[model samples]
Target: MSGNGWLRPKKSRQKLRKRGLDNPGDLTTISSRSSIKNGPGVSVDKDLPPLPPVAPLQAHRLKYKEAHSRIDTQRGENRDYTALIHALGLEDPFDDDESWPRRERDEEGERPPGEPVVASLPSHLWTQIAGYLNPKDAVCLALASRTLYARLGKAPFEALRRPENASHKLALLLTLDRYLPRHLLCFPCGKYHLRSQPGCEKLQPSDALVRNPVFVCPNARNMLRRAPRHRIAHGWSLPFSLVQLATRAARFGPHYGVDVDALARRWKGKSGDSEDGWSHSTRFLIHDGRLLMRVVSQCFAPPNLSPSGQRLLLFSRDDYFPYFSVCAHWRDGELTQVCKCALTHVPEELPRGPQSIEAKFKNSLLMGPRRPTAATAPTLCGFCQPMRRCPKCPTEYLIEIKLSEVRNHHHRGGVEFRHALVVTRWSDLGDGSAPSTSLEWAACNGDQAGAGYDSFSRLGKRAISGIFEAKISSDNTGIPGRRIMSMNPGNVKGGDDWY
Candidate 1:
């Protein structure tokens, strides 16, 4: 016996079995007889009935076990692709289960058709009713029925087609949202355009112009009527079509648009001429009929940066906005100040020996305090160390200093530990309505409504960052950190160098 005191029991220490007792061989290779040996096989293999060829494999994995299986079916026998989904006896992916009717039926039965009663009403009554209605409503009422369409004629539609009533026409077109699943409302053209790429549409790089079009538009090249887009970061912007796709799918069914997972993305930022660079990560979630967005931006920091150095590190040269995502009210808040404060916490190395004669004599008497190194943990002050929500918009921010392993191409192992400044932002992008109309969408862009966007009133107690983080993480208890507070307590903006 090998005398090792810590040796485990023989059963526990034995190697994995070569052939699994809990498994069964392939269906094609199974023996004609049932178990002659005492050991039983997988529960699935016992008393299993024979199945048709290639049912277990996917469409991409199809192969001919027998030549008869691949008969081209000129005699009309091929079931084609109706046949991985059905073989597994699963419900069709495109099928709508609930399938509500266009108009609600009464409790007694379906609503009685009233064509006779509608026809009995004089034509002048509709004209009288339409006179009190707006262009949008008038057009909708006229088209509601065949009887009404004949009586109202083309007057309401002609009125809506006028240049001044364009908004009314657009509103009228928006009503087709329920009817058209393969088309998107084109705002600039005021029409429903067939989706060029349809369900497979993908978000592309801001610079990759040709790869991003969902539907072709006549006004695409017209500078005055460009596509609506929201800025995500320095060079990244999300076009409105993608939002329409996501919301349409959520509102209707899977076939209507792409999954929300299609929008989640991770990408690196460009490091141009300067050594200081940023990396941005973004993900999306839909909650309460509203789309939420989270962006995390991080960059390595050196110790004891000057005012100019901080500016050079944070802001971009072209537009002056930071490389991270931010709402319209960024400048009015304490966001920049909080970043500068975190930078101050990055401890700078001090000289061991005192230069002055009095300091040298004082140091000789007692040993100096323990010196701080680059790896020392940074401690942030109260003013800058809490979760902050933008008082103006439905957006929140959290700034943190974390010790991260950075990759360096020049280093031997191509890795080194460094302190990085991480800024994370969460914004509610609204209920996927028209960009100009949705308050959340407009507010995030700094488009004013009356006084201004009051995020406290709009979002209430629910912090977007907290809700978003809780959703993706394993734990559902809640965000385990500091209480959320206003980003700018003073509500001050402009004219200050401190920002």
Candidate 2:
């Protein structure tokens, strides 16, 4: 009917009549329909009617509601009723069905409901819990139960190895190991000495110094005689010096000396000795990779003494000068006197508050230079007179200490001697030159004698009022080949006798 043979108003009737089809008016003719029905294609059921039209709005809404209800019912069949009820904040409506879930009771292995869950946990779980605890608490827990002990195994120690637990670990190790002597060498005898207890069966002579390792040896009696110049055996005194060093180090750090109190408390229970006029306390610490110690001792005055007797005992004398001295023996066989401070009565005006005695002691001793002047200068007596050499030579690097009593006033008074000790590396002292007239030389020689006896006495009393201290530094150039012995007035063996 149209130019492309599609239906058009003008030619549609003519075209249909020519084709002789009853359905010509329709775009789909009878021949096309017949071909489609019989064509080689997928089969369809002509007998079934087309699906009904989409339901109306009300019917559609009703169908959706029914489907949703069915789904909810199915879900409820498998739901956790306890969780659901709790989430809904509802009480149980059915007595037969409890809302709280309970584990099926196992009569053979069941624990009491009130017991801690920790006790029933596996070993691995307990170890995990212990990993969170501090080493000390973990150790205590381990000791409480055999099962926990077995489970903990080395976990506590491993935990201590961690950086966070370093302080606790150090305290434990020090507490356990402190019984071992600090130094094994006997200064006088030059032999290893183990500490001996009251009933210790170690073979030794009756004259051996008992109850202490540094003093324990067959030749202990010869200590005073061997180094007669020094009042106590240099060997026996080394342990005390180490104690002084440790005490000083502990005052600054947390770990090193904390165990001292614990150890002291333990010792108190074991030693039932009565309180006496003389008291001694010692502590040790490790600082900057070196051992430190501190010792505090109280020396009470004799019961009674006349003025002359006091002068003889307390005044400057050749046989004994009351003071404390520290000497360092280098590896190169150089024994240098680092510090020599007089021991005098504590001043009445000085404050003794809650401050640590160790800190005060360290402060008192560290008042001097790091390097000893005697190391480079010519050795002289306290009077500035030339001195002699030591009788015995040191085989190894070591430290020597001396303690004695000195007068604090011209007139007779109650006498007391308190000493504090400290050790430090030589490098800590700066490169400052020694003064032309150092306190060591001035105090020894009384060069200030022009100031008069009263002034000198006051000066001497002030000098000896505080603690004695010493410092050691690395001498990379090594000690000089020429060895010079200390010329202390306390030296009774040889040297100028002026005091």
Candidate 3:
């Protein structure tokens, strides 16, 4: 019951243990028969097919090689497999190695041939460069090479379509093609001409016409047919004197006096010669806050005027100042008669009696040179004196005229006489000095006609002592009137009047 209970005798075991107790190490080992029995379907060691005959070392290595080959084939098919491999915490084979070929070093340290030397730019950059060129230069460049031509053929035209390129296009046209067919289109008749000519050439006979050739279609037949009707619908054509007066007023306004020689020189450039026996005079004033300029001339004439048999000729083709009206008056002493030549309709009989003459003169003076029956005549004449007055305000007017004379040789071997007349009107701008609102007339016999008509016309030769007077008067209505008063020689001012 103590050390050895079941396997050895209880009392005798102590005595046997002293004798090694049946070999204690042997007692710890159990017999084969006492081992646990194998379960059903269990196999002996010899029945397990001898462990599949242990594959050869070379065969095992072959299996590993086949797996590596499949992995490499799949790596090319799946582009992202390498990245996936890296994501899975696998070491990348190419991480430390150079993906591209390393350039071989030379003593000069030059770049290798693996990469391109010059980089190619986009097409838009070349177009931007072309855009910076001038139109003419660009056109030339486009024509220089076929490649450039293909690219830039329409570039110049396309650029002109832009609003900012308008000036460029105009400059090109003016410098390169001033007489282009498109510029020769006629404004009034909407016709094109083969070449430019003076408008007068078409209207008058070659012997009676004198004008500078201009860059406009001058269809003489059309002008002659349309001129009279146009005048009737507008007003009498202004003489050279009045035209010069208006031009001066427009150039200098009311502050400066007109200088005839200076103006001629300015217009004619350095070609004008004062010794050519040309003369001019100008007078100016302010009326009802409007500026008025008058110019008179003698001997020299404008390009638009030429000599005819007994009367000075005017082409009456220019329509620059459509709103202006023209009047002509001639008097021999107290006797005055309105010239019927410039009028639309000339009366066969003259009015008799001093009162009737005065009334007719007044009517003609205010009505301008055009006949009263003319279609262009205004319902109320601008120069008419008003009948009523405005109590709160009053209007003031001024009138001035200058006479100039020049003596030149006529083809007949006698001294030729020339005269000019200029008139201007001004309106107050609430300032002390009025600015010019309109230039009435600046006319010269030298410019409009060869000389004074007195020697040529029967009526002019019958005149005794003549005077030309320009008067300004205001009525109670605060409206002012301008009239050619008496023709007495004493009433006419000399050329020095402008000073």
Candidate 4:
């Protein structure tokens, strides 16, 4: 009887019989394996829960992003960069003058001897080749190999040490920064000093610099060995070390240096010789491998000022420099005239005209108060209103006369509205390269060593006042319709026009 019971069970047979499928059929859910179209393939059913709609979290795009992260330069990701560094120098970093992908010694510190071809070259030939190179390049050439170093000897290094070659020597030292993250290059001493404050260095004003020396150096008190800084207004100057810090963090990683926001500062000088009653605020931004600085200086000015009065208001009595921030080449341009031209636009209250007392009384009653003559902000002329870029430096200036509110404790209600002159300077400090090698920094400082920085050629058409303002334009006011023009088309200097 057990052997004869090979058919379906009684309950199953009853269910199949009830559904009229006692025998399996093609494409039936009960025994779909018999389907001729596709074996074990799922069939659509309204009552069945839908197969999870193709998961996007781990799709093909996941691998694509993983591949992209391997080569992204902004985040400083590099694939086989150690191998590539054995190729050409950093300036021509991607160039390859070898037959194979170069790599360094293994973990055991074992490397093959110098190339036979390199050793075979005559010393005179190497000397001749180095003769055409600058001091920095010559040093780099010597450091490339022991064979080259022996051929070049100490001549290149000796030449780099001469006082005249200070700039060149600094350039050579800056290239070694990657190997020494715990040190910062001292431009004056031409050496890398151990960082005193390390990751937590703060940039202070010129007065309180004793608190945070970037490094301890015997030249700290030396007047000539002062850390290089750009004058941002009279009392406030930006130390170049902070520029190095901000840019290094952007290029490499955050732990190497401080974030850009940490460098931002705002302070008011109420009782200083140069910046009395002036307010200065500085902001920094990193764009296109360069550090952009914006120094906004504002000071309240009285309306209807004479030429002498304008000079007294704009120029500080101590140093005779403008209270606003400017580059070293400010004197050789129309920047002074631009500021003066903007000052002339301050709306002046004219003498009151004789009016009908009855009409005046009626208007006075109708209006809550008589409208002031200088109620609206003044508009500057085309010559002065447009942004002016220093032709010789990577600096741009915008002079504006705006109506600003000032709170004075001596006033009746401790609040007053007045016209103020605002000067905004934007500069593109170069890409953390040595100050001597950075064209923008040297050009801004008017150092004769870097005369090759043609502002129009290097920066192109869009660099004027854009690098720094691109960040805060949504919150603060921005220059919308203004065009950038050369500050000094004639390049005239020390002339009556500037005076």
Q: Please give, for residues 1-499, the per-residue lDDT of candidate 1 as tens digits.
A: 6577558423211122223334534332222123222235623344444322222332223344343464455764544456644754576345433566535434345568777888888889988888899999998889889999888889999999999998788778877888999999988888888988778876666766555578888888888987777788876777777878887888889778778778877777764644337888888878887888888999888888998988877887777888778887788868888888888787663433425666655654665532334557677889778989988889898888876676667543223457778898998888776876777887887775413788887677777877888898877765566778888888887725443
Ranking by lDDT: 4, 1, 2, 3
Using lDDT as the measure, which candidate wins? 4
lDDT of 1 at 82: 62
Q: What is the per-residue lDDT of model 2 for residues 391-465, given as tens digits with 9 covering 90 to 100?
A: 121111112222224444852322323222211111111001111112221222223421122222332222111
Q: Model 2: runs farther than 4 Å from truth?
A: 1-115, 133-137, 157-170, 173-195, 199-236, 240-324, 327-499
**lDDT, candidates in the order shown:** 0.74, 0.33, 0.30, 0.75
Instruction: List TM-scores for all candidates, in order.
Output: 0.70, 0.22, 0.21, 0.66
| Per-residue lDDT of candidate 3, residues 234-343 (tens digit) | 22222222222223334445222223222221111011232322223333343333333333322222222223411221111233211111222211121111111112
Clashing residue pairs in candidate 4 are none
Going through the candidates in the order shown, the clash numbers are: 0, 19, 51, 0
Task: Work out candidate 4's RMSD over C-alphas.
Answer: 20.5
For lDDT, candidate 1 versus 3, the one ahead is 1
**Candidate 3: regions farther than 4 A off:** 1-123, 133-147, 161-166, 178-193, 196-421, 424-499
lDDT score, candidate 2, position 44:
27
State the lDDT at 436 in candidate 3: 16
Candidate 1 residue pairs in backbone clash = none
> What tens-digit string does per-residue lDDT give for candidate 4 at 343-424?
8888764554656767666766776343334547688898998888888889988899876777666533223457899998
